[model samples]
Structures are given as C-alpha cells and as structure tokens.
Target: MKIEVTHPEPKPGEPVGAQYWRSLDEYADRPEFKEWMHREFPQGASELDGVNRRHFLKIMAASFAVAGVGLTGCRRPESYILPFSKQPEGSIPGLPVYFSSSMPDGWDNLPLVVETHQHRPTHLEGNPLYQPYGSGLTAQASASVLDLYDPDRMTSSYRGTRRITSAQVRDLLQETADKFAPTRGQGLRFW
Candidate 1:
C-alpha cells in the first residue's frame, strides 16, 4: 500500500518557531509515517527470506565438525620424561645443598652458609651456629657469589696483546711468590 505525503508551508506573516514541528513526516501526519514508527527496523533490513536461523545453525555446526576432524592430525607430538642413567656424586636435579663457609674481611672473617644447586653456588646466608658473628650477612658478602656468573667478567688471562694459558699464568704467580718469600710478603702489596 502507498501513502501520500505533503510538506506544510508557513504563512507569510507567521514565523517558523523552534517548537513548531519536530520532523517533516510528523508535520505531514501520513499513514506511511505511522507504519514506519510501528516497525522495529527499516524495510528489507529485518527480512530473512532465504535461509532461516535453524538451517544456518545446522550448516555452521557441520562445517565446524569437518574442520575439527581435519585438524586432529595437526596436533603436537607427545613428549616423554626420562630419568638420568647415572647421577653425579653430589649433584641433584631440583634440591639445593648448603655448606658452611667464611668470607675473609681484612683481619676478621664473617661466617656464612653457602647454598648450591647442581654444584653451582646460588645463594649465601649468615651462619647462625657461629656466635661471634651474628646471623646476618653483609651486603658485600651476600652479592659476592653473583660475580662468578657475571657476563662481563674476564674468562682468560691476557699478557700485552697476546692471550695467555692457565699454565703460563700459574708460572708467573709462582715466580712472584718465590721472589716475595725472601721478604716474607713485606714489599708485596695486596689491594
């Protein structure tokens, strides 16, 4: 059904105030305007003429089942855990071991308990058994173990522009020790 619409014209002497009319359709007050107001959406927007919701859902479910079956062979391979054939003397996989140690500071020593995991020193704490030094570690002593794994630390000795082996460095140290032995470490300065 078609409805006719007409636009209202204001008189020459009257002014078109702000509250005169909201919209042209409302001012015209046609049957088509009332039908448009009663609808939830515009024409052809809410119309599902071809495939209804039930058929659409069944097609989606079948597509999902086929896709799932095709992806079954694409799963990750299974991984197995194996135990070590022969374990090392004092190394364990997860547990840490603690050993009593001392940190030398000038004339005295600070008692410490060194914690090691897989034979590698991981942490250091104060020894409570030693009464002379209280059960608290100095900041310097606590952080000293971390220097063992520092990335920038020198891994090998160097003499001038040439790389030196451990044996060469040991020989040079023995020579220094022999020279200082006569003086009883008098002239040998340690920083």
Candidate 2:
C-alpha cells in the first residue's frame, strides 16, 4: 500500500531548528495526518497484531542474543593468568619497579621513568640525568604510565590469536634477510 506524508512549511521569521506540531485532536482530524499515521503505525484493539508481533519478536531476539553473549563472557578463562618464568634482578614480587627511559610525544621528547607494580603502572618520575627538565615530571608525563599499562593495549596485542615467541620471530627475520641480501645492493648493484 502507498503511504503519504505531509509536513507544514516553516513560517517566515521563524527561528532555525524550531519545529511545529499540531495537537493530537487536530492531527487525528486531519485527513493527510490520519492516513500517514495509519500507514506508518497501525493501531489494534489488542496488542497481538501481526505487525506488533513481528516487531516484538525482533526486539526479544536481539535482547536474548545480547544476554547470551554477556552470560558467556561472565566466566573467567584459564589463560588469563600469566606467571613469569623468571623474575628480573631488581624486581620484587609485589613492589613497584622503575626504569629510566626516553619517550617522544610529537616533536618534544621527555626523559622520564615509571614505577610499575603487579603489572599495573603506578607512578612516574623524571630522570635526574636529563638536561632541560632534570628531576621534574609534568602531569602529562606522570599520567602516561597509566596509558602504557592500559587493558586496551593488551587487548589490541592479544585480540584473536596466540602470541609467537621473540626467538622464532628473530630466526624468521634472519632467514628473510639472508635471502634478500643479494637484492639489497650487495652483489646486484648496477654501479
């Protein structure tokens, strides 16, 4: 069935982003509005109409699917626990560990270090040996340690598949470098 829609034009001198709506009684009395409302949403004596049932079923199915996903995610997986094979020399089991490092954000580079405890980065401090900002840490530099240890960073690295070992990656890189050495101007150079 063909549906017709009618909207009143804005009057002159009316402000922008302003809308005009007629009263329910006036809208019901208008033939064009009545036809439009009937075509868009058909009212029934009871709630068990075909169109209403289809819409209700679609909503219920979506809600059930979301609930099922939530329920499945509620159980913790065994692989979430990661224990270190060997702890570092200066690292304590539950204490924070700090290391000096240089971080460049945009054109400016800052020399700072952070203290991380139990996999969560807790605090940040400026490097004493740095020239310009010696032993003084900014708020942004301090907060950057939290960003480094964010859960989103872990999720991005380990989203779909298991991680590969660094040794396996280094061996693959060495093999590829050997194969491409000839093409990289070692003996294949024109001049």
Candidate 3:
C-alpha cells in the first residue's frame, strides 16, 4: 500500500520560507509513528538512571548463560565413526576432546586448551589445569586456525637456487655427517 504525503501550501499573500519537520511521524502521522509515541522511550533511546550500564551488562550475561544452558540439552544427528581394534589412549569417537597445550610467546609458553573433533584439532581455548598461570586464551591463539590451513606454508626444502625433495635433502645431510665423522671432537661449527 502506497501512502501519499502532502505538505500544506502557503496562504495567499504570505512569503514562502523553509518548511521544517520535527520527525517523519510529525509530517505523515503514520501508524509506526503512533507506536513509537506510545513506547517508554519514544525515540527508542531510553534514559538510563534507575538501570545503568553495569546492570545492563549483568542482565545480558545472565540471559546468554540461560540460553546456552537451554541449547546444551539438544542431541547431534547420526554420523559415521570408524571402529578401531584398539582406540588411541585419549580419543573418544563421538565426543569432542579438550587437550591442555601451549604456544611459544616470547620467553613463556602461553597456556591453551585445544578443542578436537574426532582426532583432529578444531580450535583453541584457555587451559585452566596449569598452576603457573590462570587459564585465558589470547585472540592470537584463536586466530592460529588460519595458520593450520595456510597455502603458503613451507612444503619442500631448498638449497641455494636448487629445489630438492626430502630424500635428496636426507642424502646431502648424510654426506656432510660422513665428512665430519673423522674430526668429531677436534673441530665443530656453532653460531
């Protein structure tokens, strides 16, 4: 349905001036405008005097926790699970497992908990078990998922301008080891 809005024309001998509207509702008196006028906060921005920012955050957190509790009861759909004669020590076929792990951050290894689906690591969280530091995963830990699937990650070893396979690299290392065998204690390179 199209609603036509017509503005009042100036009286016979009056000079024309700019027309100002307080709001779209004031100009058209729409049903939407009536609804807005009836609300506690007419323009939708409520004055927070009795209810402040802290109280608002608490309410929001409580609501989210309640919703999460409700969702936890739901069951997943049927899927395939490979039967192993002897399953690996920590793995449970259907349930997601959490592993306490860490990543290098300067001098310290930042504590993290990895979430695994089946046998593959899916995401990272904070590890609460370690006594040295309390559990809290950094934003960088969460973003490590991108590195797992990075296309530019080094796949092959290279020597100078020559491309080499793992087998060739192993052979070259063996040759160097043979060359250094006779002088094991006499001379060594470090740094």
CA RMSD per model (angstroms):
15.8, 14.9, 18.1
Over 85-184, each residue of candidate 1 has an lDDT whose tens digit, in order, gives 8887776789998899888867678899999986799999999999776778889989999999999988899988788999999998899999999888
The per-candidate count of clashes, in order, stands at 0, 0, 0
Q: Which tens-of-lDDT digit does each residue in 1-191 have in candidate 2?
A: 99988877868987768455677745457887676566665555445645677798899999999999899678676676566788667777877787777676664677777667865667778888887887787777777777765776853222148675667667866876787787883553211
- In candidate 2, stretches whose alpha carbon ends up further than 4 angstroms from where it belongs are 1-85, 149-154, 157-191
TM-score of each: 0.44, 0.36, 0.38
Candidate with best lDDT: 1
Over 1-191, each residue of candidate 3 has an lDDT whose tens digit, in order, gives: 99999978978988787768798776898988778777847563875668888999999999999989989787897899569988888887789998877787666777888888876788887788776666776788779867866899767788887889999999987887888899873564422
Candidate 2 matches the true fold with a TM-score of 0.36
TM-score, model 3 to reference: 0.38
Model 3 has how many clashing residue pairs?
0
Candidate 1 Cα outliers beyond 4 Å, as residue runs: 1-86, 158-163, 172-191
How do these models rank on TM-score, best leading? Answer: 1, 3, 2
List lDDT for all candidates, in order: 0.86, 0.71, 0.79
Which wins on lDDT, candidate 1 or candidate 2? 1
Model 2 lowest lDDT segment of ten: 154-163
TM-score pick, better of 1 and 2: 1
